[model samples]
Target: MLENWHDVNGLIGNSLIYFDRNDQQWHQSWIDTNGSSLALAGGFIGGVLTLSGTKPNTGELHEIQWRPLKLGRVEQIWRMSLDNGATWTPRFRGIYYAVDQQN
Candidate 1:
């Protein structure tokens, strides 16, 4: 589970991720304070965990990727496509590190 802070418009998001052994895939269920929700599923691809799915009732394709970096850091990128993936727009990009490394 994860939560967001200091988000614009006071929108807070919560997500749950898990790996399903039956299909050997990772799945994620995310919901926000604004009533938005998403369900994505995928597994490691080229060393990055990539998950993608379309938004409910919106037809917007959303993809998120997490890449591990050096020094116990990780990068997360979220993108969306409105035209069935013909084009993509970045929605969020963040780097996360351990608390002890926050210097």
Candidate 2:
């Protein structure tokens, strides 16, 4: 999570995303412990796209070039697997803190 070096701790993160230039297509996701804070990426993230082919008449190869952002919140998680992804366990868990007196 984009962190704050100050606060009694902190509540949630206020995250946003923007690319180098104002062109092309993209997609993103946002999340929070209470489903409040949001994160984003382009639609092309983890998606396939047609690429210029190395051979003639082959057109283009589809490419998938989307990277998911790992915004760490108190509620974010990471899965640990000993069997190389055969199975996984939650390695990380976020601590839930209310942002208000009544949440």
**Residue 32 displacement (Å), model 1:** 1.6
Segments in model 1 whose C-alpha atoms lie over 4 Å from true places: 4-6, 101-103
Cα RMSDs of all predictions?
2.1, 14.6
Model 1 agreement with the true structure over 1-103: per-residue lDDT tens digits: 4555547787788888899999999999988877889999999999999999999999999999999999999999999999999999999999988796666
TM-score of each: 0.89, 0.24
| Candidate no. 2 TM-score | 0.24
**Which candidate leads the pack in TM-score?**
1
lDDT scores for all predictions? 0.92, 0.34
Candidate 2, residues 1-103: lDDT per residue as tens digits?
3342222445443433344356563422333444443233334423332111111233222221322333532333334444434555553344444466775
Q: Deviation in angstroms for 46 in model 1?
A: 0.7
Query: Which residue ranges in model 2 land beyond 4 Å of their true spot?
Result: 4-75, 95-98, 101-103
